[model samples]
Target: MLTGADGRYHWPLPPATYTLTAHCPEDGSGGGTGEVTGVVVTDGRESTADITVE
Candidate 1:
């Protein structure tokens, strides 16, 4: 889990297809959640997945 003000995270993963999910807890105002699937990570390469909630 990420525990900072920047709201950034990193994970070491092997070369394969994967799925990433993020969840925001419910507050008095509101809450949201998001996910990304089919993420491909290759050896000696960089992969990116973006999730946004509103």
Candidate 2:
């Protein structure tokens, strides 16, 4: 996790291709899943989608 000034997670990923997905791991939170496809490298060059988990 990228730390913000408050030490909070600002961004969840780094430069790389990924199958970005989100799901509630908790039982009561409910089960859900989503995918973001073809997320290409997006850093070090105008910050163009170098970090994604879709």
Q: Which RMSD values do the candidates have, in order?
A: 1.9, 6.3
Where's the lowest-lDDT run of ten residues in candidate 2?
A: 45-54
The lDDT for every candidate, in the order shown, is 0.81, 0.48
Please provide, for model 1 over 1-54, each residue's C-alpha lDDT reduced to its tens digit, 9 standing for 90 to 100.
752576767777899999888888889658887888999999988888887755
Quality of model 1 by C-alpha lDDT = 0.81
How well does each candidate superpose onto the true structure, as a TM-score? 0.72, 0.38
Indicate the residue-level lDDT of 26 in model 1. Answer: 87
Residue ranges of candidate 1 with Cα displaced over 4 Å: none
